[model samples]
Target: MDKFFKLKENNTNMRTEIIAGITTFLTMAYIIAVNPDILSIAGMPKGALVTATCLTAGLTTIFMGLYANLPFGLASGMGLNAFFTFGVVIGLGVSWQTALTAVFIEGIIFIILSLTNVREAVVNTIPLNLKYAVTVGIGLFISFIGFVNSGVVIKNESTMVSMGNFTSPTVIIAAFGLFTMVVFYKRNIKGALLWGIAVSTIAAWIYAIIDPQGAAYYKIFLPEGVFKYESISSIAFKLDFSIFNDPSKIWTLVVVVFTFLFVDFFDTVGTLVGVASKANMIDKEGKVPGAGKALLVDAIGTTVGALLGVSTVTTYVESSAGVAEGGRTGLTSLVTGGLFLLAMFFAPLFVAIPGSATAPALIMVGFFMMENITKIDFSDFSEGIPAFLTIILMPLTYSIGDGLTIGVLSYVIIGLLVGVYDKGKKKVSNVMICLAFIFIIKLIVSGIG
Candidate 1:
């Protein structure tokens, strides 16, 4: 009986670790299911894109574990995906092949920046509140995307279809998923996220059975080129490089890559710093042991993913939810990586699992991000405004970089107004902040122009 009990405890620990990794991976899994819609807006075929998304993400997660040696997971970056698929492809009217080229060239630039330590120098310059704004903004952006995609926030010419139908399959499924996870969370179940996925999966299958358009939706979902329902099938195998003929496009590639690196640098840094604190991953020197290496790994992951025809790959803040569940070490990352690898092979299964099922997880993460708002020192308007900008604009602006720009600019402006400039020259942070502030001003001016 004693030996059996010991074995059980060991299994429980292992389970907790596994749960953590899976939860972290899941934070971005929805993208695997949905990125194709964005990527294919420029005529990217379905199968190839889905495969590329999964394969690249799975490979990058492994790299994060083995190379970075941190319990971090990687996938198609949240903000960059939309930007790559929307801002560049649709808004800028760039071809799909050109977009891939942009990602690839940018990945190479990132590699150079990280190895030369230039990226770190730039990153260390960003302020804490500005950083917080980036992470929280990502959370809000993520929830926004989820809500919008689930058909909850449809944009009508007059007004957006911005709420639930209550009777819609996606709506009902998401609600059920949210309710199930909330109950599980309140009940203090270990791996509530995992349970939520499971419950949601069953619910989706049940919904499909009862869906009025069951056959049609299922067929549309089972289209030829999907890895999961949302991403392209051959995302890793489909980088068509024919769009580099134009000199203007080539130069534009340079601009895109740098911009991606800048945004991703702050996004990954802020998320890791914030979530690591919550997960107790930080050590005495205000660092996690393999944190820098983990970042380097993330950069590499993005490089490889870009090459593989997917968007940027970066460490997810959602992984911290697993830390809350007691995840620790490379073991957790390895487990999550394994789950991702396995899930790719079973794309249909993952696709069949509705995202509404994960809505609860998102709502839960929102609650966590909101907690950071309390840590802001509200006594001084300077500190208070910047912090408030971080918390509110993150969700409101729906872009991490957008919110970060506002947060840092506000901090500097407010500080100058209140005479709280912490003068320094040796520090890289001040330099980055100064540069960032200038760039943000340029962006604002350009927007006005």
Candidate 2:
């Protein structure tokens, strides 16, 4: 295992990798319940989606470990799944099968791009400062997710977001969990995040036993069964290609395909950059090692996920939890993927792990990722303003892709202004210029559509 994964070279051992894997799985296991619930809104079978989600995530994550040799986990993306159901299927009046087809097409295009080095070129072209900003942005984005998940932050009409009731059991549990993590982390305990999650879960279970009705109200409780499995036959291989035959729907199909392509492409890039930056996986030249293979695996994961009846599968930002736990090799991904496979039969148990339980791990990992923010040079406005926007907009906009889009666009525009005002002072790369134009077109088309 060490020979293959180079554990010693990466300064990580099997035990650390295993704990990291478990930590990553715990942080992201919410998708087992959430993805199915969201996609079922588009009339897909919830049971079938549960199975397909696990299957796709398991297979693709394992593939990532063996092929790309990265510790990142791949799963049906949260935003993309919501877009598949609400944006394309309901709002655009496209069939679920057709939406899946669009996803499949996007995957094919991504595969081609990955193969031709287009994706790698883009990754290498991103400035180092912006890359650090992405890491910090994702850190804040993840922390926000943790806060919302734990009910520490609640939606409000007047203020947009407000504090939740401290009296809420979920909030109490999350606070205890966060406190536990902080203490363990301060003591330099191994698997502190994992311990935090375990403690939170136990506390939640205790609360459930004491007050079953209240526990159920907050959606916190024990699993109903030890073994449960759903077959994916109902939803698998259900892609609809009829959109190609209908001339009237061709424009809609094109739009849907472009949207999927655009979001998945940049979301994957931003995630890879953010998590890799946190892991120190990027080289001194600001290029991610084995990036081509990683991108390829991500593309293939999406394709296979579509075939298995799910949304686009991309490298997960939650993998940062594992990296924070000392995971540095594909061994972490291997263990994580194995857990995902196990989750297929143990669905109820994994799903019963309340979001509040995992929220602490994410929150702590967010802090670890924020350590890179100081690396960005704020002295140069051409670099500083864009970096600031990238960092702030991620959590505010609640979309990594949108944050990167605006950041890159601003970077190019500002760089141009600086160059025009003081020649040779700032020079934007050709790639950045091209990307800025593309983003502008996308924004315009989205507005018109």
The sequence of per-residue lDDT tens digits that candidate 2 reaches over residues 275-331 is 999999989999999989999999999999999999999999999999999988888
What TM-score does each of the candidates earn? 0.81, 0.98
Question: Residue 428 deviation, candidate 1, in Å?
Answer: 11
Residue 329 alpha-carbon offset, candidate 2, angstroms: 0.8
Question: Across residues 160-258, which tens digit of lDDT does each residue of candidate 1 receive?
Answer: 345656666666666676677778889998888777766765776666666637624622232223343335444544565565666666666666766
The lDDT for every candidate, in the order shown, is 0.65, 0.93
Looking at model 1, residue 78 earns an lDDT score of: 72
The backbone clash count of each candidate, in order, is 22, 0
Best by lDDT: 2
Q: In order, what is each prediction's RMSD in angstroms?
A: 5.2, 1.0
Query: Which residue runs of candidate 2 sit more than 4 Å off their true CA positions?
Result: none
